[model samples]
Target: MTDRPNPLSDLNARSREVFRRVVEGYLQSGDPVGSRTLTRTMSEKLSAATIRNVMQDLEYLGLLGSPHVSAGRIPTQLGLRMFVDGLLEVAEIGDSDRETIDASLESTDHDVTNMLDHVGATLSRITRGASLVLAPKHETPIRHIEFVSLGADRALVVLVFADGHVENRVFTPPPGQTPSSMREAANFLNAIAEGRTLSDLRSDIAGELKRHRQEIDELARSLVESGLAVWENAGESSERLIVRGRANLLPESDEGAELERIRTLFDDLERKRDIAEFLDLAEQGEGVRIFIGSENKLFSLSGSSLVVSPYMNAERKIIGAVGVIGPTRLNYGRIVPIVDYTAQLVGRMISDRTKG
Candidate 1:
């Protein structure tokens, strides 16, 4: 990871003011900034020539770029990062925005999937950008495990919880497995897997079996191993990533070339698996991971940006992540704090549910 540089002190007050006006103008209008525009936007007693000189100084530092020789200047990704880091003032989320976020998450329900769906949608609507929530890979404690023979090679594994919730999965059984061995395997699973999470149970059973290599019948052991492998490989964790309001990422205007960029971004979003995997890396970090244009390959081609933060459980352990995605010059000041707040809100909800 490249170390984030502090370029704020590199410029004087006047230079910073001029660069900020340029960046703010470009961000708000999506149009390049000229010396005349800067002179008008600022109240200081400065001429267009002075403004042009300051812009030239900023351009020399590789912060601003010109699309053509005579075209007005726009902030490059580096310039945007500098502005966000140094000059941008984040607008506080008002009571209305707070009410929106709080109301959407208001429920005593422990149905996490439903809540995550709401979270994704609310963030999308609030930010007017594509939003996504990387749900935690929380494991449920097992009540019992059962194997029903479907044929010579396949068997259905019925996982029943103490709360009476049941989930079923089918897997290939060991060669020549019989009903008697399946029943015995189920019994063995029940004895050890009680009050243990699915992930822990797999490890627990495997460790126990290794210790007592000769105690269990070979057929029963094979069935248990198969069940573990099947369920663990299902990838339910990645499946729970809720992405919403992707259509909001489209360009507001109808310029053919500009419209194609947003279209490319939409196409990139179809790779949810890749997005989720990239989000997993975001989970490994602390607070508010900002991936600017071309900084991360996921959004490089689309010229998009991402603002992500990890959501945690009661144990203070990071479980998943949440974020918003938009154009490279997306409102970082506004979206960063929103993403941070939403992550904290979701973390609190998980903690509350865990306590209940």
Candidate 2:
């Protein structure tokens, strides 16, 4: 790995101390800090004038900004990123929270959708913000496959999954074969595909399509092609995204502008494809990822942030992600470890179930 230059190298000890206090204060209260406040709080008794000079220097460096002409200083998005990356003191997830998460996932009945819903709800309760989970996907096996005629040409292909759910697709048959022949085809193909997943069955179907056969007719051949094509076109059906606690994103204030931002963020979340694609990026990394305001294009307008981590299966391949979404000035030190542990716990629990 290459060593990148540190931007804070130029800051003197006094300036760094003053910057840290300012950012910490702002994170705790979401309010700006005056020099007098820092002066009284510091271990060393520096005069208010000296603290003001350091604050001015930090502002000049673009780490702090003032909302009003004479208002105290608050850390900008850049300052928050710097603090999170270089100076924040992360807290370990408490035993209580860890137990809460673990107990919920202890059962391994394998209802993936319900498990993810529970995971999201747990994160929201812990962090007081919206939670997102990218669901893991695998090759699902089918218990049965049947073909039913809808009309003269259009046919319905039905798939019965091992989980007891059924999926139906409209299969268009080629010209020259009767519905009765199609029934024969469905019976023969069902016998072949009953015990395999669509992925595995596709290969078998491909092999059959490759060779000449006396038992298969034109419509039966089309039925095989179109049935497989439907599942192929379904496109990542096993993997999905689940979000909860959207109402948590809204702050308890009457400020119309902030409320408008929350509304915009809700709209962004409704478009799952954008958020899902962004979460997919976290799979490339090994641990928790922080995307500050304006860093992720999807949330730039809403001025939101995301802290996400990818979870893996027993094979160590990343199968999904877990994350929190909130305002830019998140409680980074406290929340980072919580999000990280949740990801690890989720991966461990899912991997254990898979092993069973």
- In the order shown, the candidates' Cα RMSDs to the true structure are 14.6, 15.1
List, residue by residue over 54-126, the lDDT tens digit for candidate 1.
8888888989999989988999889888887778787766677788899999953677777888999999999
lDDT values of the candidates?
Answer: 0.77, 0.75
How do all models score by TM-score?
0.64, 0.64
Model 2 agreement with the true structure over 83-109: per-residue lDDT tens digits: 777788888988888888888776535
Off by over 4 Å in 1: 140-277
Candidate 2 positional error at 280, Å: 3.7
Clash pairs (backbone) in predicted model 2: none
**Candidate 2: stretches off by over 4 Å:** 1-5, 139-277
